[model samples]
Target chain A: MKQTQALNLQQKTIKALGVNTSDAKVSLSYLSVAFLTLLIGGILGLVQGLERAGLMELPPWINYYQVLTAHGILLLLVFSTTFTIGYQYANLSHALGGLLPKVRKFAWTGFILMVIGVVLAVTMVVLNEASVLYTFYPPLAAHPVFYIGLVFVVLGIFACCIGVFINYRHWRKNHPGQTTPLLAFFAMGVFVLWFFASIGVTVEVLTLIPWSMGIVETTNVMVGRTLFWWFGHSLVNIWYLVATSAWYVIVPKIIGGRHFNEKLIRLVVILLVILNIPGGFHHQIIDPGISESIKFLHVFMSLSIAVPSLMTAFAMFAVLERAGRRKGGKGLLGWIGKLPWGDVRFLAPMIAMIAFIPGGAGGIVNTSNQMNQVIHNTLWVVGHFHVTVGMSVVMTFFGICYWLIPYLAKRKLTPQMNRLGVIQTIIWTVGMILMAGSQHLAGLLGDPRRTSYTTYGDHPTALSWVPYEYVMGIGATLLLLGVIIQVYAVINMMFFAPKGKTAFPVSEPEDGAPSAPMWTERWGLWVVLLLMVVAMAYVVPIVDMIVNAPPGSPPIRTW
Target chain B: MKQFLYGLVLYLFLLLPPVAALLESIMIIHMHMQMPLLILSGFLMARLIQLKFPDFFRKWNSNGVPGIMLFSIILVYWMIPRTMDEALTIEASELFKFISLPFLAGVPLRDSWKKISSAGKNSVFIIFIILFSLMGWLYIAADEQICNNYLRVDQITLGWGYVTMAVCMAIYVIQLIFGDHSEYK
Candidate 1:
């Protein structure tokens, strides 16, 4: 027992002194894959944008849909998933004093599985055998290999989820009666949501596999769409939750202020976890095979998410104001001026949070049944995601990279790199505003999304949209440049930055603040409540879709 | 008192004509959502009642088994398809539903839950899981509409609801079995 205690003390000292080389290797590998995918996806995004604006034409072999599919899958699925795993695993290791050996094995296994899956899926897209787009909605079926690849991806996610869960349980067992570190808690929320969310899409993909293989003659289109959105919408919230983790934990430390009330933060995380999956119905507000009354009920359910979001917004402002006041700033808004605006770590996520104001408001507009009718399949919907995912989520991720990459690589964050990151953030922000803004305007003017550029025989209305399309092309060009700079900064930080130690920034709670309540630790209870809410939201409509399903659609390769 | 007031507000809101009609418009909402919410309201209100009539509960439910048995009976009676049909069509049956679910099942549940042993609580969960799975099978497999007011599809939906709830309870039970709460506590 004495030897075990001594060994544990030694281990803790080692962890506190520097990054564990093994754990750093795991995270750095994932980050490497994430940035590489970003580079490829960024190029594809520019190509698609330029093509849509009629500034460039694709060759005969590579169609617009093919490029679109590859871009969405690479950036949305591969890049984001890899980065999240990398970051969350690093958090787990830091907070829990390093992952169990088995958990690290799980991480590496997940990485291999995901890489294999991406290769298979991307090969299908590149060969033009699968151009169903990232949503992969039927009857536009992909190659059976594509669906098989997705299954592997889901399995990979499950591996990571299991790893996180095991590490959490081990920590809880050892600590006993203590609340988990805040970052670990957020990691748990992300993985739990990821696990449940993937279930719906996994089911969808499995059925699609058989159908695409001609083992099944046809598939239920409505059910397929419903299941896809069930996963798709929750995936957005998962990214949002990850961003908020950084906002709540890292940003406060960077700004030299304490985090907000622990209870309120935990409450927000809990509420988000319970309420997020049901909001998927709002994505289907305009889809058929659902009753008007049900859709109306779902509007309320979706809007329920706004409660926690408002709470977050309020908490963030309070923290900022309190921090600014401590710096001896006077007057009503002078406190804002006291903030470190020049710090890319603060600026990127700060702008991301600001973008959420419009992003969230636009979300409300989309959730409303009547409002959704006006912009359902338009470029406005595209614009909305660009603001939310691109600015709010991805920007936060970029900010994280500046510190996280250097910390893992045991390197100094050079001032030059910091300046470049700020520049990249500015360029990315301006590019997104220009691109997403024009998309919104064009959509309001009835410009459709997911369509190749067409003149409709040079109709006046079609010709009028050309200006907005050109702005989008220019914005895309700038965004690609921003991506290049970001990738370069990340590479330099990882390999070429001067060797040194960097601290992981996790903010303390306010002095004399009340401790988080024990009830928040009851994860089993929370899971049950989440399941009950999901059952309440999904059972009726899913049953209706299956029982009253239309004649199933056969697989079609539109591309 | 605050809990009682909130509960009263919930109970009154549930009693509102439009709210009642809207919830009952769908079969699963009527049986699963509305009924469970009524029980929750009563659960919330039970604190005030327990304070007021401490001896009344103590005398009859000292061992908790009596109160829990009453709760189980009330829940099982309501789970019957005929009871739901009658509650929809018959005035007295509907009134009984509004009275019995909250006052009978919900109140007793709150009173007994803490008093019961871990084994007793697990038994309750086990019983419910078994009962719900059986009901789910019956509802999903039935050739004819079991309830007059609800469609066959609605019945199947309700079956799935039962199955899902049962699954949730099963999970809770499994966690309880595996989770060493003593370590955390």
Candidate 2:
């Protein structure tokens, strides 16, 4: 009994002292890399957009494809991965009281490995040795060094995953019969998805290494494409899962409300983990070699993700409505008006959540068998991801920075900084609407993606897309401005904001809410289920691709 | 009652010609997916039966040994490639498969599971693991098609499916051995 009280007191002291300095340093370093990548990637995006709009010309040394490749890799892969790690690690440390010593070492090892990997990859891109774009789909082969660098990135991710698993297991052992803190649970979900999602891409990259080196005469293009999507699609959800973690836990506290039912949250996490990897097939809907029946089954698998997403939408509204009503707001729609609209911490993710309604609908269009053929290689697909990833996921990450950076740096978010964040959020939302909305319209009008500026002798249909392209260029410029302000806000909060303690806003469960079930903690079972689902989804089509082999293709350089 | 209704709905859905044809068209799906789903439906439906005839279960399978034995025999009978071929070709065998797998195998397995000792449960997993490994090896290494209904490539796919299933079961057993469940529970 005395030991229990002492332990509780010790934990309270740790919480009062704020995030541990060593842990804060690790998270802050990762955040710095993430924002730095965003700055560079944002610049590249502006260049590409203006060039695509026929407003700018690239010099002989630099090309549009190289800029596009770097933009995709830096923003999509590096920025998201680094920010998730930094933010999730901070959550783990704050929630678990502190990370295990070896876990901290593992985190540093991962950071170093990832940094080295990124440097190698970006150098290859800059030197024009590899401009295969982010997907790296063969017969457009990259330098063997680029693929090897990707191997390093996957290995680095594995290091972080192992660290999280070890820490989770240690906590479970120490606290018998007690559920982990909600944020720590979210951390576990994020890393579990990360570990599994990377497997398919790792396999693809390993094969490409041999093929790219001419060690193998040719590679199976269909298998390569299939494997890439398996990883590619899951990467989308990893970001979604990370964003939803903030929505479910952090946002509620920011709005002064208890979180929704704990069981539903855990269930959403589990469902997302299990149903995620197979959804990658929808990305390959128009790709050949897979039979129609298998594609039909895959369509079902892909749509299964909507179930959890809808559940999340329902839960978020419930939390907001309840919180608003408690503050004396009346009537059915009046609660919407009562939310913290002025707070950047709430406003950014609030708009992010709103963006997902359209974003998710666009996804369904892409997943459909017929609709995919209509916009297969069009900018509509590009527009879909930009809204989904750019607004829905990245904006949430932006909101998190408002509080997260300050908490990690032991600083207060001054009102001026908060006001700047609100402005940045507004600019970002407006920019994305103009950019992604026009991209969708142009895509429907037959504009292709990943292609340099071409007028096709001033063809009428081709000329029709020019106006949308210009709007995209203008929107891209606005977005770059937003990115600059965001980076500034992050830096200001991290180093220059007034020094004081800030709370990590993990919310409590509502009064009378039942505890999450013990079965939800059985991660081993969840993993086995995940493996079984993957096996079921992949075995048929993959086997057919291998057994009925076509003549494989040698490397081709399109540029 | 809810379980029974869910089971009935699943069973009826599986009975649909298009659904069954689509699932059975792929050899691995026929065995691994369709067969397991049939068993799941029966497992769920068994709750109603257990409630309806508690005395029947108590008297015939008091220790769960008899029920488990019945399940093992029926499951083994279905795993034979010749049996799968026969069910596709001969309508009588098909009827027997539909009847025997659910009523004899799945229902009895569900009743037997909780009543069995932990060691007995482990033994069941061990048996399946060995069976799956042998099946995987036989199907993968065979020169000729193992089943007349399935193409050689389909047989190979089923072989890989068996191999993956065995790997999954092995992982489960290993975790069961090493994991200290009391820590979390």
- Residue A510 lDDT in candidate 1: 99
Q: Write the per-residue lDDT of candidate 1 for residues A170-247, one digit (tens) a residue.
A: 878777668899999999989988988899999999999999999999999988988888889999999999999999
Clashes of each: 0, 0
Q: DockQ (Cα-based) per candidate?
A: 0.68, 0.70
Q: Where does model 2 exceed 4 Å of error?
A: A1-10, B183-185
Provide chain B TM-scores across all predictions.
0.97, 0.97
Candidate 2 lDDT at A237 equals 96
Q: Candidate 1, A60: how far from true, in Å?
A: 1.6
State residue A446's C-alpha deviation in candidate 2, in Å: 1.2
Judge candidate 2 against the unseen true structure and give its global Cα lDDT, from 0 to 1: 0.92
